[model samples]
Target: MPRIPAVPDAEAGVVGRLVYRLARRRFGSVPEPFAVARHHRKLFWAALVSELGWERAATVLPATVREIAVYRTATVVGCSWCVDFGTMLQRLSGLDVDRLAHIDEYATSPLFSPAERLAIAYADAMTAQPMTVTDDQVAVLEREFGRAGLVELTQMIAVENMRARGNHALGITDQGFDAACAVPQGRSLDGSRTP
Candidate 1:
């Protein structure tokens, strides 16, 4: 359970109910963060809008590159919820989720492409304490994925940092999203066990 209880659907206002409905339709459930954030309506809407905007705008990098970088950031931050959700997203996108088992060895692992390795390394640097991101790293990323792509990549990593940190602080662990992907029909969006 999270430090703060999620606002139950019955207690959610009209607008919150609509947003929750949309979330359930999109991701098979209202994310715990969304439910918790609904306690503060304004911040909830801001987060919802920001997430949607970023999802639409972040199309500069290849899906694989963008997703791997974000996943790497989540892992580095040790956010179980982000890791679980990221795994499900990667699987749904048809990326090689199996390769994630070798993430810690990505630098030398054959499972990751050279480009993926670069992005993963960048995520590590960006997420590290004191942020080890270097001038050379930025230059390399820029060279590989133009200026616009680099900016998009940076924004994605930064956003994941915010998400992972917030979730961790709130004690939000895995919501079984990865498991839900395996047997989607068996689970309900409201987190109820269905027969």
Candidate 2:
């Protein structure tokens, strides 16, 4: 359970109900964060809109590059929920989720492409205490992904940091998204979300 209770359906107002309905349709269940945020209506709506906008607009970077960076950040931050959700997203995208087992060896592992290694390194830098990002690293990324793609990659990584940190602070755990992915199609592992 989270530090605070998730807003129950009985307390969910009209807007909250709509948000829950939409979340159910999109991800097959209401994410715990969304339910928790609904306690503050304005915050809930803002979070919902920001999440939708980012999903719709974050298309400039390759999915592998973006997802790996975000996944790396979540792992570094020790956010179990983000790790679980990221795994499910990567699986759904048809990426090589098996390679994640070697993620800690990304620098020397043959599992990751050069582009992925660069992005993962950048995530480590950005997520480090005091932020270790160097101008040279950004320049190399710009060359590989172009300015637009680099920007998208940075934004996605930063957003995951925010999400992971928030979820960690709130005591939210995996919510079974990874297990959901392992189960047969059209079924959820814990009846929370579908793979």
Candidate 3:
């Protein structure tokens, strides 16, 4: 259970219902963060808009690189919800989720490419206490992804930090997205059977 109870569907106002519908459509369930955020209408709306805008924005980095960095940030931050959700997203993006088991050895792993290793290292530095990101790290990332792609990567890592920290503080845990999605034709976040 979260430190704050999620606002139930009955209590969710008009805007909440719409947001829930959209979230259910997108992620197979309304994320706990969304359900909890509904307690504060404006905050919920802002979060929804920010998430939607980020999703629709174009990025230059390959999905694997960006997602690996984001996933690393979540794991480093100890946010179970982020890890579960990130794994699901990575799977849906057609990336190999099996390699995640070796994330701790990314620096020496044969599974990760050179560019991916650098991005993962950067994520580690950025996620460290006091943020250890360096000029050289940014320079290398810029070379690999260009200035625009570097910016996108930075923003994504930062956003995951925010989300992971928030979810951690709220005592939010994994919602079984990985397990749920694993079940063939399983129920969605809304508890409706997926075809």
Q: Which candidate is the best by lDDT?
A: 1
Which residue pairs clash within candidate 2?
none
Ranking by TM-score: 1, 3, 2
lDDT, model 3, position 152: 89
Off by over 4 Å in 1: 180-195
| Whole-model lDDT values for every prediction | 0.86, 0.83, 0.82
Cα lDDT of model 2 by residue, 103-126, tens digit: 778999999999999999999889
Question: Which digits, one per residue and each the tens of the lDDT, describe model 1 over residues 5-80?
Answer: 9999999988889989988998899899999998898999899999999999999999999999998888777777
TM-score of 3: 0.89
lDDT of each residue in 90-189, candidate 3, tens digit only:
8888899888877878999999999889889988888887788899888888898999999888999899889988998998888878853222124232
- Tell me the lDDT of model 1 at 25: 90
Model 1 scores a TM of 0.90
